[model samples]
Target: MLFVNLPVSDLARSTAFYEALGLSKNPQFSDETASCMVLSDTIFVMLLTHAKWRTFTSRPIAPATTSEVMLALSCESRAAVDAMVDAAATFGGTADVNPAQDLGFMFNRHLADPDGHVWEAMWMDMSGGGASA
Candidate 1:
């Protein structure tokens, strides 16, 4: 129900970061000035310059370097999550120091993107969802 647009200093760098996550840019909404990253069939991320991005938001910005929120996405299988994490590493991302924990029905791996944005790649078993953690 919500489409998020993030502000970045460089459009090319931001595009590369999302591409490393296996997402493609929507050319229809993208141009040299901005990039519209396709997150899902309906979800989109419009990466805009700070000046243009402020037009859509009035609140103070959260610096990606110090912010604590790590965008998370669910994967269909454990291997898929691992692959994403591995790809991130291959694209100059850093894997979280801790390995993914297997609580019987859930698996997760965390990695930091090139811009220091943290993302969690996870998979949950529909059977239980691992109530404990």
Candidate 2:
């Protein structure tokens, strides 16, 4: 809840990916070895080198080959969501293997960065009359 820490094989590459998404890093928590990405006022993402990240968790890291969890981020508008997905591609990332689907009240797309980490960009229409999640 307080923060989401992601273990990336290459810190620089991961940092670039996030930067392309319009997020900035807090220099205080960043160094040559790691980058702390500021997602919002309350949420932060600590992008750590695989080795450095392991030190903070006891469980074995999940291998992308067999298991993976896609992280979803909400956007303020449909255009914002599209822009992020486009930025990912320009930064050497890939559009979600599966195309986006519109669900009347929401529009969602998935994207994978160069390191094979998947992120979902989504937009919801609060005025569309759907119950808040």
Q: In TM-score terms, which candidate is top?
A: 2
Which pairs clash in the backbone of model 1? Answer: none
Per-residue CA lDDT of model 1 for 6-125, tens digit only, reads 777777887897898778898998887778988788777777877787887798667756655667788999999889888888877677634677776888988876556677888898
Local accuracy by lDDT, each model: 0.77, 0.83
Query: RMSD, each candidate, Å?
Result: 2.7, 2.6
| Backbone clashes, each candidate | 0, 0
So what's the TM-score on candidate 1? 0.79
Error of 1 at 66 (Å): 1.4
- lDDT at residue 127 of model 2 (Cα atoms): 79
* Candidate 2 TM-score over all chains jointly: 0.87
Q: Tell me how candidate 1 scores on lDDT.
A: 0.77
How far out, in Å, is residue 62 in model 1? 2.8
- Write one digit per residue (lDDT tens) for candidate 2, span 4-101: 77777888888988898888999999997789899889988888787887788877766655327788899999999899999998987888656897
Candidate 1, residue 61: Cα displacement in angstroms equals: 3.3
